[model samples]
Target: MNKASTARVTLDPENWDEFRSLAHQMIDDTVDYLQNVSSRPAWRPMPAEVRNSFSEPVPHSGVGAAAAYADFRERILPYPNGSIHPRFWGWVQGTGTPLAMMAEMLASAMNPHMAGFNQAPALVEKQVVRWVAELMGYPADASGLLVSGGTMANILGLAVARHARCGFDIRQDGLQGAGKRPKLLVYGSSETHTWVFKGLEFMGLGRAAFRSVPVNVDYTINLALLGEMLQRDKEAGHLPICIIGTAGTVNTGATDDLESLAAIAREHNTWFHVDGAFGAWLRISEKLKSLVAGMEQADSIGLDLHKWVYLPFECACVLVRDAELHRAAFASTVSYLAMADRGVMAGGIPFANLGIDLTRNFKALKVWMQFKAHGIGHIARVIEQNVDDVQYLVDYIRKSKEMELLAPAPLNIACFRYIRSGMPDDALDRLNNEILLRIQEQGIATPSGTTVDGKFAIRVANTNHRSRREDFDALLEAVIRFGREVEMK
Candidate 1:
């Protein structure tokens, strides 16, 4: 080949020094953004032009790294969902930390495929899983997997429960071949997250397989009604495969009586599973740990480190008490992935054998680094502060004549609505809805809305470690100002 034709092609930067400079500048810009996040709006609507810019045709050629970075800064950086904002309390989202952000970059640079090989990344994931299991009081020897979020975590836990308790070879014959088998069912409180029903549907059980047991006045599952339903289902020839208990309901943070629920599951010989997505982290808190007393007794647990542990997005875990049973549910023997006694392919059980994803990312790096950087004690204190902030808001609502506390604030979520005298329930709902829209549109603070007892409520779920008591004050002041403005309209 001629000299020109012999030139090699590579993705490396043409100028190493220039690329290094650009990388350093990017890191500096990120630090500046994080430090000054509070000065920006919690959220803002994108302008029409900014929105239209995304419709530009893809570049068939190439945009240099510098040009791409500039585009990101101009168009993407300014518009986020506002979960990172200090005043954002919307939908149980976590406000990430600087340390975790840096850890994410490091993990991406390494780019290790997490599907089990004899690699340090696999060991890191295993250690992270062990740390989470120990923190939640689950069995130390339990098998666990780091999943995307609460929904997947819950689904995996329930899948294991089904495999263990179905009394048939579910993996071999599938649900169709279970001839004359009783219809399998799952149970959870009405206050449970929609993940349970969605998980049932994904597992081919249909939504009808989930029995929505009513809750008590406090929003915890009513044990009496649950027992009665279990008896009725049994009489009707339905088999209860799993009993899901909610540790912290999304609406109001009301924890069910987990100990009693565990007892009931034992009595019925059903698998006990706890959906502790955000609340399970309370086990780290000395003051709040008592609320989730019986969670340790669960056959399996689904929890989110992203929400309560304040890690970045897409980090959650599902822990199963019986490691063997967990492996049996998801393990597959692929000839190509066959293990060797000693080589790059042999060490610990591949995470692929425990869950659905065979090609996984190094999601455990951020979790591991965050836990190491900030010890459990410090994290627990942050959680306690969040709960205290919510309690303060609840007390403020109780004292204010224009606001109503619609649900109990047991942990970090407070559900209340703005109200005026002589307004009917329907009118009040409309008024509060307007206030919520105004608060969001005005970029004062992002507090999500939900219906509590047929009344529209402004739901504040405080998972933001950056949140201060003053942020709640700002949120309340904006709510009142917007409430009056909407009422006048």
Candidate 2:
């Protein structure tokens, strides 16, 4: 007997009234934290003592949930990645909505696993996936699965592509089983997100399996160069398995020529996969939809709801045009998961057969609630506002004598560098880096750094809906002030 002396026990609270009181307090604290976030630093370094707090050995007994909430409030919420702050222009991150937070709470309380299930969660997931696919202009019958984030979504898309093109049963026999297989390869611009390459590697397609096609001055894929590479690869008897197009390159937010890339993929008889991780949500913006034109032509696409869609963390989806191909890539015929024609299993659409994860979180609840709480029209308006903010910053940068715009202001990223007359490239690099650290250390704003066309640039990604021109103005002032201060030293 595991516990002979224990009272007949479950994890449920002994007193519902007391538990409800605690829950209400936590909810209020969370709401206050989010509502008042703008008043705090975009990010702050955690103290050494606080860091040491986590070094204690794991305990066999559990602390009460209320006590745990106290630790989270004191040690965790104040030390977040700062992606939710109004001035956080570092990476392509979404500022989550309050609706998503409450929805997640309900999802946790339900505690339902969505893989291979016949339940309400399965229906919600199916409906949300359809809405997402329709928003992105995919066919009504297309197949999709909720995944952790963009990277896994990309992997799932590529896996389907790999299976379809290889013409061999990759599930039964991997890359090696095919005798004398041509060096299978995918093509992408130099500016494609690093996640694609990471996906390729994780899928057993080594990094060398990707061909780096050059991009034009505007950072769009150079069509002529892409044509030449495709032709040359065919002539050399190598397989062009897929063409990976990016709707928004992370460094400068440059969208590739999707229509042109689609044509090339068709001519080459290869799969066209788009990694529209953060930028695909540009579909929400009527003003910017033209930039991602022909996104509908992709055989598959990877999208991150957590990025531009403003959902909570780690929510993304992959949609495949061919439902049969997607199912063939991942479906299992195990005895326990057999489909039924009646009773509990009859009505539910099996989710585990669609992707890598068999036991998946109820990610669809947050997405579904988001759509129901704030309609797509409201989301689109916010997207349009962010794009306008990017343009506003670009205009401000051009008028600033001390700052030189390094790349074209495309989409929502503006790459620029601080310049003082006659500052050598080497000296400018060092000074700008120091300036970045100084601004961050001072908690003025958080903008990440990147090399734009071989020149170090301060890369500002304005994807937050909470941002306004005043925030951008403050960011610029901090950059200039820090740049001048660092130059003096």
Candidate 3:
């Protein structure tokens, strides 16, 4: 037998002492890492040797976990995408809050498997479902399940939408012989996250099946264009299966006109799906809620708890307006498994029936703890502050002669770049991307890049609550210094 099997063959854990000690060390090391990360480099230029280390084969025997831990301390831990660093504005990812971190520890300790109603995890996830529903101003009866991230949430939501449109029997009989193409059509803004395409691919619909609606200057879907397209599609006898509205697109943080999109969906009887990955928290702020007006009109909504909520990694919720439709998409019965009718003690409203996952993690506890510790108002204020900071940076960019705003800073993400007076379009794009690379190599900050109307621009996303006005000022200084140096050379 293998060492792992041999160790676990007995009822008790054979190396429990060693394992427990290593776990304690891991926790201590992780705590130290998180605490000191603010002072550490925002990123590190990984040498070729270290990159090659990751390619080596696994050591099967004798190499102690302590040795493995040493390697981690020396290498892997130091080199991340710098998500935890306050200066790392590269992506929409958020640095988890301390409260959420502690809650994460507790969650790991409990290790609830939220697959079904028979487990304690079910109750915990149920609490999350209720909380997410309430946040969106929906009824507490709304059903949902926690998934890894926005990608999984979108996949699950699309699956439910498909089932609702095609009927429930698809789950049992499979799509193998399912009649026709079902004319499955999905709608999203041109600026929608690539995950929209990823979800379509996962759902067995090719990228060609989706219709990308035009976006306005702010990068939000133009509702008029969407309406015209919908009318045209209906006239062509095409199925208008689903309409997806973004509450904060990844690129520019522009929210589609949700109320208008919802109205259009209702008029045509199309399933409305909202991918509110980072921006759904706008529901918490009455001031920002107008941006996502009519989000509740969505038949299904996807929200990432990790972002904005500052929860630990991999927690997203897929909420459906009709719980039964969610069930119809994912419900199955096996003779050996605990099967009960809908609404019984161990039966109805089971989260497992709402999504693809069966052996799910207890991602709810951390989010729950965060909300309890920091009230909704505190989060709203933080989000508002982030918005203000982004606006401040936008103003700063506008004032600078060397830098220019590529687009109006909307929400908390601004896309801009260093202006090159005489460079061609292709050359300017390369220089801006080079600046992004150089910034990462310097290990002070890691800003991203995106294209706006065929022009490459620096993408700064203010999703971290830790960012202050000083941080924004420093970023501006860095941009100016870097831009001068790059242009001179």
Q: Write candidate 1's Cα lDDT for 224-265 as tens digits.
A: 999999999999988999999999998889999999999999
* Candidate 3 C-alpha lDDT tens digits along 136-219: 977877878888998888778887877776533544666775664445688889987888788778877778778999898878
Candidates ranked, most accurate by TM-score first: 1, 2, 3
Candidate 2 local lDDT, residue 100: 95
lDDT of 2 at 23: 92
Sliding window of 10 residues with minimal summed lDDT for model 2: 167-176
Off by over 4 Å in 3: 1-24, 167-182, 340-349, 487-489
Give the candidate number with the greatest TM-score: 1
Cα TM-score per model: 0.97, 0.96, 0.91
Q: What TM-score does candidate 2 reach?
A: 0.96
Residue range 1-489, candidate 2, lDDT tens digits: 576886787899888998999999988888998999889998898999998898878877989888888888898888887888888889788788788989999999998988846788888999999999999999999999999999889889998999889755565775577665677889999988888778789888799998998999899888899889989988988888899999998888889989999999999999999999988989877888998998999999999999888898979999999999999888768666667877666653467888888878898999999998899999888888888898888998899899989999877899998998998887888888888877776777888898877788888887797887899999889888877777443
Query: Taking the candidates one at a time, how many backbone clashes does each contain?
Result: 0, 0, 1
